[model samples]
Structures are given as C-alpha cells and as structure tokens.
Target: MKAAITLESVTIRTELRPGDIGYVIYMHGDIYSKEYGYSLGFESYVAESFVEFYKQYDANLDRVWVCEHNEKIIGFLLLMHRGKAAQLRYFIMEKPYRGIGLGKKLMNLYMNELNSLGYESSYLLTVDELPAAASLYKRHGFRLTEEKPFSDFGKPLMEQKYELMLR
Candidate 1:
C-alpha cells in the first residue's frame, strides 16, 4: 500500500502499489461507461497503456497520484515523461468527490510535480465530453493544440489535445 498524505481531510497517495492498477482500470472503465456511454474498447485501451507504462516505468520522471477518502480511492492523475514534455493522463474524480476543491488540489499537485521534474511543458488528450475537466485544464493555462473526430472507440468522439507551457 502507498503512503497517504492528508490534505484538508482527503488523502492523496503518490505511489502506485499492488491492486492500485486494477482499481484505476476498473474505475475508469466503470465510470466512463456509465457517464459517457463508452464501450469496453476504452477500458482495453487503458489497460494497454497501463501495461506499456509498467514496462518502461521510470521512477525519476513518472508519477501517479491517487486521491482517496476514508481509504478508498476517489480520483487519480498521472504524469509521464514524453521527451521534453510531460504527458498528463487518467485524470478523474468520482462523482461524489466533485465540487469540493479536490480537483483543483489534485491539478495543482500535478503541475508542481511536473515543474519539479523540469518538464518544459505538459500535454493531455481528452474528449469533449468532459467539460468540467476541460474547463479546469483551461484555467490551468492549457490551450487547445488539436482536435479531431476519433472513432477508435466505435463512436464518433471529438478528441482534443491540450498543452501547457511550464516555462
């Protein structure tokens, strides 16, 4: 189990321990399907990405933050090195955990981590369905870099890429 750090009654863990990966995958799969009508393909894609990240994991340049309440993970975000840039991934918060400033706190933690790692910029890929997250990204200085129709999940979804220059 990862050590938990409390922030205003919420616990945020920076380490990815055993069973954390499964929980992350399950949470994404279940939440996305219920919230956006996404199919299993999305979960499969997540699993693949997790596997790839595991294979090439770099402790010095990669991090995953898991947010918890009452010892249950309620949200998570990832920062992975991508050359000179950091890639933000799997940023999500359970519905019950929204609107309480946890999202903002998690984001701030992510940005601080990236800055400490010396990343020049950070980027993330997200769908248009997540207006709240998109708004948060925008508020954090991320600008839309690309948008395109993506059907990889068996539906016509608008995929967007956002980037934030740290320097």
Candidate 2:
C-alpha cells in the first residue's frame, strides 16, 4: 500500500515534464475506471484533447498546475487559451488526494490567471457525474450555460458546459 501523504508533503509545479502527459492520461484511465466506472472511451477522449492542448500550446497563453507528492504526480489541471477565452481541462486528482485543499489551490491559481490574463471569457466541458468539480467552478464564478444528455463516453450522461465572463 502507498504510504500516507500529509498536506505539507504535496508540491505544485507549473512546468510539464517529458512523461507528465502520459502519466496524467494513465492516471485518468486507471482512477476513473475504478471510481466512477468510466469506460475506455473517456480515456481516449482525454488523450485526444491532451494532444490538441500540446499541439497548440503557447507559453504565454496557457498554464498547467502539476501537483506532486513524493515526486509523483497526484493531481493536475490545465488552462488552455482559445481565441478570446480560456478553456479548463483535465482537472483531476487521485482519490486519496481529494477532501484536501489541493484542488482548491489549483482552482484559485487558475481563476486568478484567467482573470488577470485579459480573456474575454472562460469555459469548460464536463460530465454531470462530477458534482465536486462543478461546485468548485461555480464557487469560482462559473455558471452552467448548457447541458445535453449524451452517450459519447459509452455511458448515459449529461455533458455540461460552464462559462465565466472575465470582461
């Protein structure tokens, strides 16, 4: 079993390393499958979006927070720049890392960056299964603008879109 990690043992880094994306992808597949019963399609979708994020990445306009414990990734989130807005993606943490302040720390950092970067607006897409995330987004001034029931992830779910206007 993995040893317990105290909050002080956690570290948040902004730079992406060589294997970070792959590890993030693997974590999503492994963690979600066990926790939420998410299927392989969800992981595939994450990979495709991560590929797009990497391809279009701009140091000036994009940001990511990689949370590590004992030099291993435990959580992460990304803020991707769109035409005149920001898109939040891949905000995730391992099961053991939840109920802690790390997610809020990432959100606070992401929100501050979004507000200061001069984006006209910001948005993200998520499934209704993620109530905790939605709650965090709402607390950070994001509002649910749209939702549609879909099976694209190989399961019945509501695809939700949340938006925040910075301008």
**Which lDDT tens digits does candidate 1 get at residues 21-128?**
889999989998898888899999889998988887899999989888888988999898888999999888888778888889989988888889999999999888
Give, for candidate 2, the lowest lDDT window spanning 10 residues. 2-11
Q: Write the per-residue lDDT of candidate 2 for residues 40-129, one digit (tens) a residue.
A: 998998999999999999999999999998788999999999999999999999878888788888899998898788899999999899
Q: Candidate 2: what lDDT?
A: 0.91
Which residue pairs in candidate 1 have backbone atoms (N, alpha carbon, C) closer than 3 angstroms, thus clashing?
none
> Model 1 Cα displacement at 128 (Å)?
1.1
Which number leads on TM-score?
2
The lDDT for every candidate, in the order shown, is 0.88, 0.91
Which clashing pairs does model 2 show?
Answer: none
In candidate 2, position 96 carries an lDDT of 84
What are the models' TM-scores? Answer: 0.93, 0.95
- Window of ten residues with lowest summed lDDT in model 1: 2-11
lDDT against true structure, model 1: 0.88
Instruction: Provide C-alpha RMSD values for all models, in order.
Output: 4.2, 1.6
